[model samples]
Target: MVRKKFSKKEIFTGIACTLFALLILSLYVWHQTESVSLGYDSAELEYRVTQLEKEVEKLETIKSSLLTLDRVENIARDKLKLSEPKEEQIVYEHIEKER
Candidate 1:
């Protein structure tokens, strides 16, 4: 049987290469994890945007209802005890514009 011995230079080169390969593998894993995390964050942000859009639509609907002329008239007549003016209470005004 013959036994072979590796030289110091060869051993050092092998160890360095192994360390470099490990470093690269770790970097690749870290990058992949970061990419996945960012993907999840982006999805969450998209969901939030959708929720906000829905809320905006709801608020707009409420605003429209509140601002309707019929609603205002009802509030004025019922709550404020206001009524339409009589024919004798009406008046007309004319204004002239100068160019």
Candidate 2:
């Protein structure tokens, strides 16, 4: 029976190769995890944007209703106690244009 003994250099080389392979595998796993995390972050941001858009639409509707002519007239009449001026209290203005 003949047995071949491994040299110290060969043993060290094999260990280094195994370590390098493990490092590559770990880097791959890390990259995949990072990609998944970014996807979740993007989804969360999209959801937040959708919610903000809805809120903006609601706020715009409220503003539109508040700015209606009838709403403004009612607020002025009820809050300021104002009324239309009579014929004697009304005034007119005239301007002459230069030719």
lDDT of each: 0.94, 0.92
Collision count for each candidate, in order: 0, 0
19 in model 1: Cα distance from truth in Å?
2.0
* Model 2 lDDT on a 0 to 1 scale: 0.92
**Highest TM-score scorer:** 2
Query: How many clashing pairs does model 1 include?
Result: 0
For model 1, residues 1-99, the per-residue Cα lDDT tens digits are: 998899999999999999999999999999999999999999999999999999999999999989999999999999999999999887554432331
Off by over 4 Å in 1: 1-9, 85-99
Q: Tell me the tens digit of each residue's lDDT in model 2 across 1-99.
A: 999999999999999999999999999999999999999999999999999999999999999988999988888899998887899886564432332
